[model samples]
Target: MARIRIDLPEHFAFSTTITLLLSHINYGNHLDNAQLLGVVSEARLRFLKSMGYSELDVEGVGIIVADAALQYRSEAFHGETMKVEMSATEFHDFGCDLVWRMSEAGSGREVARGKTGIVFFDYRSRSKVTVPAGFRGHFA
Candidate 1:
């Protein structure tokens, strides 16, 4: 199988720092893959909040992550601060991809790069919805 390749945007619209916790480590003594995703989730939340939105409510429509792809580049240990940079890309009629990069805060060593496919959804109607013009305009 071919490895996943995600081309990230040149500029990140937002960034937030996060520290790895003891629970984030695995028996291998590095940040666990699953925990890294959790960190990404948090960073995504902060990014949206900064844009006046949330995963549960973006311009009156909620978002659902349809897919995720991550490439782990380096090990991250507990207690070290890392930065998660986030931006939006690949906008479609119904959705877009949220791209991200993670790096060590001080040294800027790349830790991971990822993208999550996010689709707008209407929970009350239980249906997928078109991307809102205002939402795209805000990010654009």
Candidate 2:
């Protein structure tokens, strides 16, 4: 199998902290692999909210996760606070990639790095839509 390597940007536009809960732990006593996405989802929401947007409304268009990839660096335990840093990149006509890195808050021990591909969507029309100009302008 090929290892996934994510080259993070020099700087992140947004960051938030989340403490792992007991529910986030798996049988092996670390952060559950599946729950990692949940953590990222929370960070993504915070990133958008800081810009006055939501998964259901980004400059008049909703966003759907088209794909996701993760590269785990280390295990995380409950009660550990994670600092999640995120940035938007890889823009296309209708979508972009939201890349992020997670690390232990104080120790700076990396936990994971990943990207989520998001495509603009129109819920009323139930169709894909073009990326909003205002949204793109924010990144520019």
Candidate 3:
């Protein structure tokens, strides 16, 4: 598949500093792929909160990861500080794509870049839902 450039919203900005945890590393001693995703998940929550959104608010329209992609550039070892920068790229009728970048804190070495495609769903209806107006406007 062809790769699409992730264009972040003009005014969007959300970031959090994180230290590599022992539990985030694996036998090989760098940040594990799975653990990196967990870090992204944590940062996503924090970002939503900073934007005044809660899980309930998200759940109202139903957001779920439909697909994800990650590219690792450098190693992040234990005790090393890294920053996860996140922003909304674009919103579709039923979902949205989120763009993210991770890098070493002080060194500024890029660790990874990625995007997650989140789909909106209606739990009660058990079907895909349209993106809520409140959220769509926030990123628009």
Candidate with the greatest TM-score versus the true structure: 2
Error of 3 at 52 (Å): 1.9
- Candidate 3, residue 17: how far the Cα is off, in Å: 1.4
Clashing pairs in 2: none
For residue 103, what is the lDDT in candidate 2? 100
lDDT scores in order: 0.93, 0.96, 0.81
TM-score of each: 0.97, 0.98, 0.87
lDDT for model 1: 0.93
Better lDDT candidate (1, 3)? 1
Candidate 3 residue runs with Cα over 4 Å from true position: 1-12
The order by descending lDDT is: 2, 1, 3
Better of 2 and 3 by TM-score: 2
Q: Which candidate is the best by lDDT?
A: 2
True-vs-predicted CA distance for residue 85, candidate 2, Å: 0.4
lDDT (10s digit) by residue, model 1, range 1-140: 99988788889988999999999999999999999999999998998899888888998989999999999999999999999999888999999999999999999999999999999999999999999898898678
In the range 2-75, model 2's lDDT, one tens digit per residue, is 98889899999999999999999999999999999999999999999999999999988899999999999999
Q: Kindly list the per-residue Cα lDDT of model 3 for residues 17-73, writing each as its tens digit.
A: 889999999999999999999988888888888877764467365567889888888
